[model samples]
Target: MDRLAGTSGFGGVYGAGIARPQRGSSIVIGYESALAFWRRSRVEDPALTRELLAQLYPDDMLATLDAEALAADTSLRPLELPNSPFERIHHAALALGLREPVDIVVGKDAARRRSPSARCHVWSGPVSDGLLVGVEPGVYICSPELIVAQLASELGLYKTISLAMELCGSYSLLVNGACEYGVPSSTSHSRISSVLRLSDSFRGIDVAKQAALYSIDGSASPRETVLAVMLSLPRRLGGWGCGKPLLNAEIMLSAAAARECSRSSLRADLLFDEADLDVEYQGREWHTKPEDRTSDEARQNALMMMGKSCLFISREQISDEARMDGIALLIRSRLGLRPYRRPLSTGMSLRRHQMMLDFGLA
Candidate 1:
């Protein structure tokens, strides 16, 4: 996406813009520093990183990053940043309140000693391509997609899938692997690296591809992410293997239902459109409120009027493996799919159990 040249963002940071910087300068926030940034900032879905930085940092802190990183040219060229990956990561660490030794990505050619600086960890790799997302005129962070690909190298497939789900969904994942349902996803579909967009050029692309296979967008809460993964992922991987549902899908109500519900349309948490069903996730935190419960009932009635039966999945129900499996069976039956022949053995238990563990459900 082309960034607006002069628009201002939260805390006086231009939400999208790049200042000209000298070529061959390479200061980019990455790895552990990137993790810290992603965790601390709960940016709105359609947002830029500078908004977060601007709130936490002074304007001048980004001024150096904005300088000498580009050349004056009417035309653009292959992107490169200034050559100080360490300085970049250090600043990002400070900005994100990271206390651990900074992790910086250096070119493969950069020298490494048997023992390098104790204060920072060095990763040998070049920061090139479109992997680096510009946060401001000069500052950059690993793009959300790049971060996923980088992390996939070290994480298991379940964890990788969990991370991909959060990224694809409309919510953010916390450092502790908890979903911050209140925090909207920072990366938009156009900006996030998606399953279909996984490229061979990236490291761990194969793993990322696998992880993103069943991930769908528009999940507004953590439970929805888990629910979708549980239902949609292949049975071989311990998912119920029901058809993946469209998450947070907006459905316009018929004239009668709309007037009855007092709304033109409603978004279902997990929409089984083909089955004419709406699976709603009721979070313990808010849905218990009397007013919210009343509203949910009304929404369900309105949906039913359109021939879509509504199935409610409570936060409590999601926590129980037996209950969730039962729910999945019910959904598959409603969708007219054959029963999933669940296997009992062959090492499926741990892998199946790990999905819950990774998602903090277990």
Candidate 2:
């Protein structure tokens, strides 16, 4: 009798003392059961499947199957399944042009059966349909709102807020009656607010709610989101406590003026309308090109010609805590606000410190 094939894409057969099939076609039992088992286990990526099996199973058992020969034979493989929630979110974030790291929530049943690993985290809490997005058959992921909630539960307040800001600042809302990927609308703030209200009973909902206040839509990058949060967070929590600033605030230009300035419009990364202060984050990755640098200089000059004060924060400046403090002090001094008190030392909480590192504040 022919032995049953294993469920992995790295084709192989299983069972003890089972003879290889004769010249005729093989009779495979449990084919449907094996497929269902793989799908339920979230073993979607073939490459990841190989890695997991190698890590989890005994070498002698693996050696029994001709993994290399099976890998070369495509017909023996299982059907390719949709990615796990972790991978789905990562791809979704990339599709939506977000740069923040994606966090995931593993169901309790799956977590209980498998050993913890870095590939995905175990979510030891309740889950419901409202929190998930079913993208394909047997594939599930957290919706954007639930993603924020999971981050809040796992990463704490500051990092969660920072991630929420990144999401709102970079991506538009996912509403119906639009394209498959959805249209770019300025509904991130409102959508997040609604999510907070709906998820009020979820774990870590309080922190998620508080974090929503600091998030603004229309941010262009992760760094820009962090910069906005740093400036707007209250000083009591070691932030600059500056009033909320508009992100990517537009400066309109007439055709003639635009032609003369060599641009159509100016969108300040962070704009304080009351103080007329424009804070820009210039990362080396995007600003290293000579043309990019020249264009930036010209844009700054144009803003200056319009009587706007501009502050350019480089990657270096923001990476250093002392330099960021100085920048905050300069802004406060210019706005005629009270003297900048040295940002209170981040309290002696290990979790807070980890959060700071995660959000790149450290």
Candidate 3:
């Protein structure tokens, strides 16, 4: 392939009356060079190569080359070929050693191309260099900011921000083994802002901006982030519109109080200080353990005794619309907000409806 750039083009090499090899004979002399060239280039497919060869060469000309011998050539090693950007991103993430699973662009055609063992959830949007980080050669993955923006596009303003908070922590699912991805906690906010700036003209940029406005830097888990967003998002966006709350806010305890509680301090997942509200999200994975359940119950009781009203949002409740609506109403009532009145006709745009559904607003 490289030699094609020289004065002796493919035509020049063959037009010089070069002798043809036997039909079933191996052409091993330049096999390594050809294999190296193919590996360094794009993906390889024997069928596609044959089709192209048939187009470029006469049938008799192609018949002289041994297809079986070419295919069985040990000089050509197998190379990994990713079928889509998602696969490329997965490989790149592994190469870069990212701590959390980053979101990838999955356009309208994704359903047709989806595989059973896909690693990342797809986002429907335009993907460009602005959204990807190239790690190893030919491996491109979404950058942290791009990941946040993509999440915003799919998950809406509130949830995306909350996700950013969770991703900002040291521990993320993307990292390998016991070690966590060592991302700086403070970088989450700034990176989101930077991404917003770069993606000013991008589709769904408005939603990304809105999510960034509510994103805080400290969320221990995805459930916690969702709970915070649900509590703080405005009613117009299909949320209760409660005031923004501190996330993972610590409650100091006296030595005697600590002894009684068997801990020196407690951190509320979401805390509305003025309203004296403490919200905790108990995902089935963590809260199912007996020890965790017991500790959580004790913590709730302690918080209640301290004049703080506690709301425990379960994983099931989060998934159920009726329960979520009830929770929303309860939060509004506690925050002294008026009862939510659904519009007679929402007149909602298709984009808005999609965004609402993506953010769990619906």
In order, what lDDT does every prediction score? 0.60, 0.51, 0.49
Give candidate 1's error at residue 130 in angstroms: 2.2
Error of 1 at 102 (Å): 3.0
* Per-residue error (Å), model 3, residue 48: 42
Q: State the weakest 10-residue window (summed lDDT) of model 3.
A: 26-35
CA lDDT, candidate 1, residue 330? 90
Most TM-score-accurate candidate = 1
Sort the predicted structures by TM-score, highest score first: 1, 2, 3
**TM-score to native of every candidate shown:** 0.73, 0.57, 0.53
lDDT, candidate 1, at 74 = 10
Candidate 2's C-alpha runs over 4 A off are 1-132, 137-140, 171-187, 254-260, 285-288, 334-336, 341-356
- Residue ranges of candidate 1 with Cα displaced over 4 Å: 1-24, 39-47, 50-89, 95-100, 109-127, 136-139, 174-204, 286-288
How would you encode candidate 1's per-residue C-alpha lDDT over 1-362 as one tens digit per residue? 22223322223542333333334564445665676567556543335344443222122322222212211221113333344445554555566566546444443433322212113224322233233555544555665555666677677677776666676565675556665665545443333333225245545667766776655767777678788888887777777778789888899999999987899999888899999888988777765489887888888889889988888888788778799889988988998998856554666667778787877788
The 10 consecutive residues of candidate 2 with the worst lDDT sum are: 22-31
Higher-TM-score candidate among 2 and 3? 2
Two-way TM-score contest, 1 vs 2, winner: 1
